[model samples]
Target: MRLAALPRRPSEPTITLINVVFLMLIFFLVAGQVAAPVDRDIQLIDAAALATRAPDDALAVRSDGTTLWRGEVTTPEAFAAARIADGAEVLRLVPARDLPAQDLLRIANALRMAGAAEVRLVTDRSAP
Candidate 1:
């Protein structure tokens, strides 16, 4: 009589996938730039955070709803106009810790009027 066939080991397809994922993660960590606050002079608001970090080209606003571009005070309309003229589709705004909610919304609306597809708010990531 012939002997019964031996049992085979289970395949580990997930292991290869896991390895590739880890390699990609490590590659991104090494290649990506670390983020710093948009401006040292403009104290950013602190709140629940998001995954995406704003780029260095963000527009900063002070507590009084005064917008600053390239370290110069500017009206929201002016800032939006210049940025839109430069072919920017997405606008990143860093509002001060004491900036009023109404001001923020107004500035965002102005940016939208200037053809910004998206206006992302950037906040400070402070430990509680």
Candidate 2:
């Protein structure tokens, strides 16, 4: 007598794994914070005072007094001429920890003259 052939088992579902991985990708894209890349050579200052608010945009100043606007080396005049977002009123200054205070003041003044309503100095909160 001929025996009936055994039925083959169905393949394991892979769609569930694909769905889970897709969901995780979406979650990370949504929850991860996107920040401007800081220059590797620059170092930021630390302050004891808490920041009152976050900055809308950031400008980095190196310890040697070179200014970086959006990661590109820029001058005060060029920075002033650069069109700012219509609703952007606050400009954040990220200066090197060793940068002279006088240079910081000069940059702040230039930004003010450039029509920034507010210039906030970004500093790290000192550890308690």
Candidate 3:
């Protein structure tokens, strides 16, 4: 008996790389960096009974005895020069919660000598 000829099937298709490239692009877009406000490590003591708005010229002192001028580390002299250049008439001091009393005094004195017309202390309000 003669065997019938069988029909040939189609060859295997090549892999498509377009989907993989698209997925990689989407992954990178979702994992991209997001811009956030820059906050220094300085902690402020909230001794005041209520919260008050601070002026543009604010000096923050960290618990580790480090001084920050607008979220930037700076010495008293440098801070003074910057303040003068920025035309700051008054300086608001925000001391960290665990800041040493002596350090606060030194900062206050330094701010006073830096040509600040007045110095105001800032504190956060306690939760009810």
| Predicted model with the maximum lDDT | 1
Per-residue accuracy of model 3 over 33-63 as CA lDDT, tens digit each: 4545357786667756555443447777889
* Candidate-wise lDDT, in order: 0.82, 0.76, 0.75
Candidate 3's error at 79, in angstroms?
1.7
lDDT of candidate 2 at residue 104, scale 0 to 100: 90
Top of the candidates by TM-score = 1
Candidate 1 local lDDT, 3-118, one digit each (tens):
99999979799998999999999888877756553776886666455454435578898898878888888877787778888888888899988888998898999889877889
Query: Which residue runs of candidate 3 sit more than 4 Å off their true CA positions?
Result: 1-56
In model 2, which residue pairs have backbone atoms overlapping below 3 Å?
Answer: none
TM-score versus the correct structure, for each prediction: 0.54, 0.50, 0.51
Find the 10 residues in a row with the least total lDDT in model 2: 47-56
- The candidate with the higher lDDT, 1 or 3, is 1
Of models 1 and 2, which has the larger TM-score?
1
lDDT of 2 by residue, 21-117 (tens): 9999988887775755689999777754545432335778889999887668987656655635445677778887899999999998998898888
Q: State how far residue 52 of model 3 sits from its true place (Å).
A: 13
The C-alpha RMSD of each candidate to the native structure, in angstroms, is 11.4, 15.3, 16.5
